[model samples]
Target chain A: MLEVKDLRAGFEGSEIIKGISLSIKAGEVHAIMGPNGSGKSTLAKVLAGHPSYEVTGGEVIYNGENLLEIEPEQRALKGIFMGFQYPVEIPGVNNAEFLRMAYNARQINEGKEELDPLDFDDILTEKMKMLSMEKKYRERNLNDGFSGGEKKKNEILQMAILQPKLAVLDETDSGLDIDALRVVSDGVNKIKSADNALILITHYQRLLEYIQPDYVHVLSQGIIVKSGEKDLALELEAQGYDWLTPTN
Target chain B: MTTTLVDASDQAESALLNLHKKFMSGNRPPEALVPLNEAAIQRFELLKFPHRKHEMYTFVNTKELVSTVFNLPGETVVSKDFIKSHVYPECESSYLVVVDGILNEDLSDNSAIQSSINLVPLKDAVDQPEIKEYLADTIEKENDVFSAINTAFISQGTLIDVAAKKQVEAPLQILHVSTGSASGNVTSHPRILVRLGELAEFKMIVKYVGVQGNYFVNSVMDILVGEQAGVTFSQVQEDATDAWHYSKTRVQQGRNSRVKAVNAFFGNKITRHHFEAHLKDVGAELLLNSVSILNDAEQVHHFVRIHHEAPHTNSTQNFKNIVNDKSRSSVDGTVIVNQGAQQIFSDQLINNLMLSDNAHADNKPNLMIFADDVKCTHGATVGQLDENQLFYLKTRGLSEKVAKELLTKSFAESIVQTIDFPGVVDYLENTLLKKLEA
Candidate 1:
């Protein structure tokens, strides 16, 4: 389970997400929808312990641990994953190698046995098959020269391999096509179990039709103003954020 | 073996005294010491040992290195098993051993050498009339001090010749090993001369390794490519860190010829390398690449010059350095194009990844041109790892140290990935991993 107590985070000196709070129980998917500059991505980044975004206030408690106090890598070892809106292009670094390292990082952190090269290949191949990723992606540099859809699917593939306790998807559906979206969504659904929680951050409600969130929350001006069941996502999709603003 | 810093007063001064006297009092220098033995010595007399004030020698001062002496080297013998264990582990290779700056004839391969290929040591190459003529005629006599010193006090080296249109199936491994003691501060000159005939293709791997001792090595190499010849050379410097090494490599490419070079520098207290490539004919192509990792108080400087003389030529040069501790590095590269060299496409980029705050890297990419119809660009960047990439990697479950190492390795992979040999590529990767972990 994950509980955020009045989280306030932002860049340099100014606060972007001010006094925001939320809670998500295990085995459930939570959707956070907001307009542009509403600080949805900021919240996800803060939870992932990005150094650029300073957490001036608030506490992020995840599975009984203060996530904010640890470094980004430590947070990652504790089962926190972020699927970026735009994946980085690390040329000359093989995708297979990076994925293996990521998997081993968590294994080592949990005091579990790590996988060797042969076993790593076997498991990674199975995971890649499920994601429908081309075998060539294994040898190519991470996200280097990759298309929008490939980058998105690769992100999903990483999430599948890490099998983290909590995953924060940050606009993962932005540049993906319908085929890529369906594949990524299916991969995410396959990994959802009783031991982990999913935080879906998106502006459009299209991805919700596949993952099916347990609760829908509307964020604006760095604050959560509304929360309800799945029906709220549909309502917001139909009416937009116009009605939420105060009138004269 | 560790090289302790002796005070400038007693032991250190005596070491310097012994090295200098032994150098000047030695018997008449060998004939192979220079392209023009007497003429080159005069040039050496005019130039002085390098000082820190020299822009190219800023990080590594040759004066401090040459002031000490080394034991004269003896016995140019290397066991076959040692070569197998150290240089080529994956496959069988034809080897050339140059011990103490002199060619070890018994250890070298002659029967396996191709019919079109002529392999001779400097002891014999100097006797050939044509060799003497071209050795000094192709390039200018040394204006720099260290080069003149190498010319004036040199002993021997290696000469490789590949006939026109001949291609060697196996890679050539050139091993320059240092052994023996000549007494107070020792010095030796090693030279490599390679000539590729028209339409020939070959790859050479040169290793400059030390036998155990605090020695100083000074070497110069001359390489020439004939019309349409293609060559790729890789230099791996894992010499003794306690020694001072100063080296130079000069190359010239003929019509339609192509050359690709890469240097892997991983050693020494003070090491300096200079590379110059002249594209003197039409349609010539050259690619220069290098990667160096320096730690402790070590300093490494690499200077390169690429001159384009004809139209329709292509040239690209890139050098990367990873410095830690208080080590320092510098890269100066120049790409010149003449007026007649229209349609020349050239690009030079020098990038450095500094691992510590005190470590420093100075990179300068210079360009001078007399032609307007050419594509030329040069840039340099020095900084730490990318923060975004670091964060993204760490968020994937890697520890901060692991993530940083991966990124740094990736930065170097840009150049190493271009190596055509898969085994060599993997070997370099593992070596870099160890360095990063350290």
Candidate 2:
């Protein structure tokens, strides 16, 4: 469903994701783990069509289309979703209303009837119930004053509502407590389907224990150095990325 | 060439003075307001029209307003349908309609709230003691030429008085509509005085609307809150595109009294609003919020001053401006804590969102604290929408235009949500959305 060929992207004049290539098929889950400043988030942002990053050299094809040519909003409408590591806090936009807008946008894109507030409320309520999110999240401003764990849960809630085909979860497990982590993982697992794919970007293997990935790729210095099964995560957890570092 | 310009400016200045003289010549004020009118005219003469060199009018350019020749407004008869369409649905039977600065008793119906509150035209209430004591007394007339001019022609206005220990559930609506004369441009001076007794609670929504043609509406409103009284005042200024609006609102709070004033400006070619809230007694609280959405060549200026005169007083001022195209908006807000007013808390914030490169916003949030152990903070921000915020909304599948409009509406919602009245919020939201779309 997704293919990245020699993705070379960065901000300004500095290169971050240099000469990285990866591919994922339908229903496949991939884990991209790297050390700090290893361009893990940069790759996610590049795929999400972030405006700040310049793709100097790369080709990303999603669903037989050049995904890089699509606008950020068009990407989302075309079933591309990026779970931001730090979701922006919009102080006055109600969370429920924002979710409804996103849902309706996707509905319109797919030639479906738009849902009004009352109709959308039922869908939103069911999604929140499935995720075990508090009702207060519906009325509060979008991510304003939300705790770190709550923000991550909200992201997962968005993923559940939109039901995106390709979701890049960037640092989704970084700020969650044990209970919240379990709840978020359960939400992702419930939303997972045979036709959808997930890319979990993380620095630790704790989240892997809940939703195991089909493939694990180790990224260092803007390049993937190793690719293996789920056990590679355990080996990396035990020995750390130091052993993977090349001695020029 | 310079002499010709000076002559034109002098002719414009004298036009207003001549209009005042002609108005007083035909209609003599009541005996109780004779000296007040005389003193106001004298003050107007001494102060004259504001120039660019004036400190208070530095950011506000009055060249166009002062150069225009304006005649005293003639009688204006508006249809009942127009009044009904302009007023909020909740205030159907509890409204006062003022046309061309004169209260239209035939069109106004306060029967729903007349039992709980006293609603009288200023012309008929001049003999009352409260009217004599508080009328035109709250505003500072030393430097405000508009206030002085409004006082000079304050015979026709509205006076509202709430008794002690009364909780008026119905919101009082004052609709000021300006209809220029058929002959030429006209000017109207509308005045309002509201007094709440001890422990009284009241809510008011003042709305301004105008018909086509160029006209000026100079309005003055004074509100006095008694001990433990609470008041919520919402002012919506939606004048015509060619109209000029100038208003001065002064509020005085008694011991333990609370007042919340929300001002929303959406129309008018040029608007100047002067607001002052005095915490005269201890424990008095004041909340002042203003939102101005302007586009094209529209200009709006706000001068706000909050005085913490007594100990333990608190106040918050939030002013937001959404300027688009070539429009310009300025806010000069100052909070002063007296020397002995300790334990006072105050904060002033000014947020301006410039939607276009040609748009401009000038904000000055000032703090003058003389008392120790007081908490006061003031900050101003002038910028376009946050790029990160915009990108976030766009990534949610919202189109770029929809995303920008939503973000703009959210910026003003922070202030709009603070308004507690029903129907007013919906009206403001619709107006804001229309402006954003435009």
Top-scoring candidate (TM-score): 2
Error of 1 at A137 (Å): 2.7
- Clashing residue pairs for model 2: none
- List-wise, what DockQ does each model earn? 0.62, 0.73
TM-score of 2: 0.93
Kindly report which residue pairs in candidate 1 clash with one another.
B69-B185, B69-B186, B70-B185, B70-B186, B71-B181, B71-B182, B71-B183, B72-B181, B72-B182, B72-B183
> Which tens-of-lDDT digit does each residue in B1-438 have in candidate 2?
778867876787688778777877776666666667778888888887776678778679888888888887766678898899888977888999888888888989888898999877676776787666565453233468888888887666767889999999989899999987556688888888898999999999999998665898999888989999999989999898888999988888999999998889985688999998889999999999999999899889998888899999999888999999999999988899999999999999999999899998998788898999999988999998898999988888999999988899999887888888868999988875478876
| lDDT (Cα, tens digit) per residue for candidate 2, span A1-248 | 99899999999889998888889997989999989888999999999888999999989999999999999999999998899999999987999999999999999999999999999999899989987899999999999999999999999999999999999999999999999999999999999889999999999999999989999999898889888999999999999998786334
The weakest ten consecutive residues by lDDT in model 2 chain B span B133-142
Model 1 chain A weakest 10-residue run by lDDT: A239-248
The local distance difference test score of each candidate is 0.79, 0.88
Docking class of 1: medium
What are the models' TM-scores?
0.86, 0.93
Tell me what TM-score chain A of model 1 achieves: 0.97
